[model samples]
Target chain A: MVTVNGEQKNAAGQNLLAFLKTEGYEPERVVVERNLDIVPRDELEKVVLEDEDVVEVLRFVGGG
Target chain B: MEQERKLSKDADPEKDVQEGKSLPDQLQIEDPEEVKKQMQQILSKEELDRAFDARFPKEMQQKFRGARVAIAGLGGLGSNIAVMLARSGIGHLLLVDFDTVDVTNLNRQMYLVPHVGMPKTRAILQILYQVNPYLDYETVQAKVTPENVKELFGGYPIVCEAFDKPDQKAMLVRELLGQCPESTVVSGNGMAGVGDSNGIRTAKFGNRLYVCGDRTTDVGGGVGLTAPRVALCAAHEANKVLQLILQEDS
Candidate 1:
C-alpha cells in the first residue's frame, strides 16, 4: 500500500512517474514527496515506489 | 514661526509629488521651511524606536528585530503580507514591484483611493510606516526575473512570492531553489473564487518552499479574487515567516 496525500493506494511496485500519471496528476505542476523526502522534478522517473511508502503530491494554484 | 506652522499644516504629501517626483525626491530640496514641515510629519528617531518595542511582544521582539525578509511583489498578496509582517513586529523587509497602483486593484490590493497613481512600492511603504515606524525596509521598483531574481532576493533568508502570474511565481521559486538553496520561499496558489476559507492551507514542498492556498482555484468563469481570501493566504505566509524567524537555528 502506498499513501498518497493521506489516502492509501495499492502501488506496491509502480514507478513514481508512472504512478503520478496513472493517478491523473500533471507531471509539471505536481511536486512529489516520497517518505518525507522530496523527489526532484528530474528524478521522478528514476524513482520507484515500494510497499508502505508515504507520498504527498502538491501543485501550484492560480492566485496571489 | 507662524509661517512655519502654516507651512507644516498645509504640507500635503500628494501635492508635494505633483511633478512625478518620488516622495524621497521631494524631501531633497534645500528649503528650510519644507524641511521643517516634513520633520514635523514624521516621528523622531527615539520615538520610532520606543514605538517598535512597545508595539511588539517583549519576548519575540528581538527575533523580529533581527530578521530580514523580502516580499517579491506589491499587489494583493505582497501588500497584505507587508502590512501583516509590519504589525507583527518583523523589523526588516525588502519590497520589489515595477507596477503602480491601479483602480482595478482596489478590490484586493492594500491601497487607498488617493493612491491610484502612486507606485505600489511607495504607497505600501507609506502605509507600513504608519503601522510600525521603525521597520527597516528597501523597495526596488523593478521586475523580478530569472536574471535578477537572485540579486533581488539573495541576502534574505526568507522570500515571499506574491506575483499575480503563475509563470512568474514558478520562475522565482525555481531560481531561488537553485541559487539560494538555504533560503525558504513562501508562495500562494489557487486562492481565487470564493469558497471555504478553510480550504487554504500551508504545505512544505521540497526543503525550502512552502505554498499557501488550496492549490486548485483560479480566476475564470466569472469567479474573481476577493480580499478576505487573499488576506487569509497572506496571513499564512506571514505566519510562516515569523515561525522561521523564531526558529532557533534561523
Candidate 2:
C-alpha cells in the first residue's frame, strides 16, 4: 500500500509521474515529495515508488 | 569731590583691574547655545523625527529585541526583504548567502557600490544595521540544504523564501513542511518582468504556506522586474507572515 495525499492505495509498480498522471494530476502544476526528500520536477520519471511510501503532492493555485 | 569719592568707593577699581587681567585674552567659555545652533543648522527636529518614525514604529520599536530571523538568500528578493524586516525591528537576523554582491544587484538590491566584493549575507547585514542601529544580525556564508536546514531554521517560526532558483525554493518548502510543520513559509514567484502594479497578488495555500507575487501569467518572455514590483512582493510576503503571527485568517 502507498499513501498519496492521505489516501492509501495498492502499489501499481509504475514510476511516480505515471502514477500521478493516472490519478488525474498534472506534473507541471505541482511539487512532489517522497518520504522526506523533494523529488525534483525533472526527476519525476526516474523516481520509482515502493510499498508503504508516503508521497505529498503540492499544487500551485492562485496565490500571492 | 563727593561724587568722585562715592564712585571710587563703590567701583573696586583694583579688584576690577585684577579680574580683567586674570581673564584670558580670548575668553572661550564652552557655550551650549553655540553647539545647539550648529546642530540645528545641521538637522531640524522634524527631520530627526521623520528619520526615527521611518524605521521604528511605536508597537514594534522594541518588540523583536531578542528575536532572530534567518534570511536564506541575498539577491534581489532577499536583499530587499532582509532590509525591510530589519528596519521593522526584527532584533537578531541571520543572513545566509554564498554569492558575492555583484554590479547587477545594484539595480534592485539596496546594497551600495562598496559592497561589490563582499559576501551577500555580510553586505546585506551591514546595510541592515546601518538602516537601524537597533538590529542585531549574523551571517551564514553558505547555501541552505537539507543537511543544515534544521540548524539554519533554529526554531524560527517565519521564513521568507527569496531564492531565484525554482528547485532550491521548492526544496526549502518541502523541507519546512515535512520537518517543521508548525513553521510558516512565504514564497514569491513570477516577479521577474514588467507589469502593472495590480499584477501583484498574495494567496494562501493552506494554513501554513502563503505565496506572493504575480502569477506565472505575468512571466512572459520580456517582463523585467524593477524595484517597485520586487518590493511589493516582499511587502505582501511580510504582511502575510505578520498575519500568520497574529493568528489572523489571511
Candidate 3:
C-alpha cells in the first residue's frame, strides 16, 4: 500500500496519471509530490507508484 | 473635505453690501471657517505616513514600509489585494497583468469607468498611488507563463497568485515552489458565489503556501461570483501576507 497525503491506499501499481483520474482530481489542476519530490506536470504519465511511497497531492480548484 | 464655498481673498465686504450680494454669513449651513480649516491642511507624505503608522502597531510599522511583495493577475483578487497592501504602506509592489480594464471588471475589480481601456497594471497603479503615494511600484504588462514566472518574481520574498483559471494557478504554484526556494506564495483558489462568508479562509500548507478561499466553489459552476465574496478572499490573502511578514522575526 502506498500513502497518498499521509493516508495508506492500494495505489502502488497505478501510474500517477491514472491514480489522479481515478481519484477525481483533474491532472491539470494538481501538482503531485512523490516521495517528497515534485513530479513535473508533463511527466505525470511516466512516473509509476511503488509500495511504501508517500505522495502528496495538492489540488487547485477553479475560481479567483 | 468638501469645497462648498469659494475662497476669495480680494472680495470687498463694503462693495458687496452696497451691491446687495446675497451670499451672507448666515446663509451657509456649515461653518465656513471650519471648512476653510479642513481645506487648508494638506497632508505631506510624511504626515500621511505618520497617520498610517498610527494605525499599525509600533513594532511592525518599519517592516510594513520595508516589505516587498509581488502580485500576478490584476483581476478581482489581485486588484483588491494590491489596494490593501498599498494602503498598509508597503514599500514596493511588483504588479503584473496582461489584460485591460473591461466594463465587466468594474463590478468586482478596483477599476473605474474611465479606466476601461487602460492596461490593468497602469490602472491599478493609479489607484494604488492614491492610496499611498509613498509606495514604490514596478509594473510589467505581460501575461505570466511557467517559463517566465521565476524570472518575473524571483526577487520578491512573497508572491501572490491571483489567476482566474485553475490550470494557470496550478502552474504558478508549481513553478514558484520548484524554482524559487525562498519565495512564499499566497493564492486565491475558490472565492466565487455567495456561500457562507465564513467558509472562505486562509489555509496554510508546509510553511511556503497559503491559499485563501473555500477551495470548492468554482466560477463556472454558476453559483455566482459576487464582489463581496471575492473581496473577502482577497482580504484573507492580504492578511496572510501581513501575518507572514509579522512572524518572520519569530
The candidate scoring highest on TM-score is: 3
Share of reference contacts found in each model? 0.51, 0.04, 0.69
State candidate 2's TM-score: 0.65
What TM-score does chain A of each model score against the native chain A?
A: 0.90, 0.87, 0.93
Q: What is the C-alpha lDDT of each candidate?
A: 0.80, 0.67, 0.84
DockQ (CA atoms), all models: 0.48, 0.10, 0.69
| Tens-digit per-residue lDDT, B53-114, candidate 3 | 67878678888888999999999999999999988777899999999999989878998886
Off by over 4 Å in 1: A1-57, B1-41
Please give, for residues B1-250, the per-residue lDDT of candidate 2 as tens digits.
Answer: 4564446456766666643223234423233244334444545546655776786665444344444556677787788878777656666777778899888778777778877877887677556644554446677898788678888874877777777665566677767765665577787765665566688788765556777876563333555557777778877776665555445322
Candidate 2 residues A1-64, lDDT tens each? 8888788978547799898898887676566878856676668899889988988776543211
DockQ of candidate 2 against the true complex: 0.10
State the local distance difference test value for candidate 3: 0.84
Docking class of 3: medium
iRMSD (Å), candidate 3: 1.2
Candidate 3 TM-score restricted to chain A? 0.93
Docking quality category of candidate 2 according to DockQ thresholds: incorrect
Q: Which residue segments of model 3 deviate by more than 4 Å? A: B1-42
Model 2: fnat (fraction of native contacts): 0.04
Give lDDT tens digits, candidate 1, residues B119-189.
98878877776676666768899988778977888878999988877656766776777667667889887
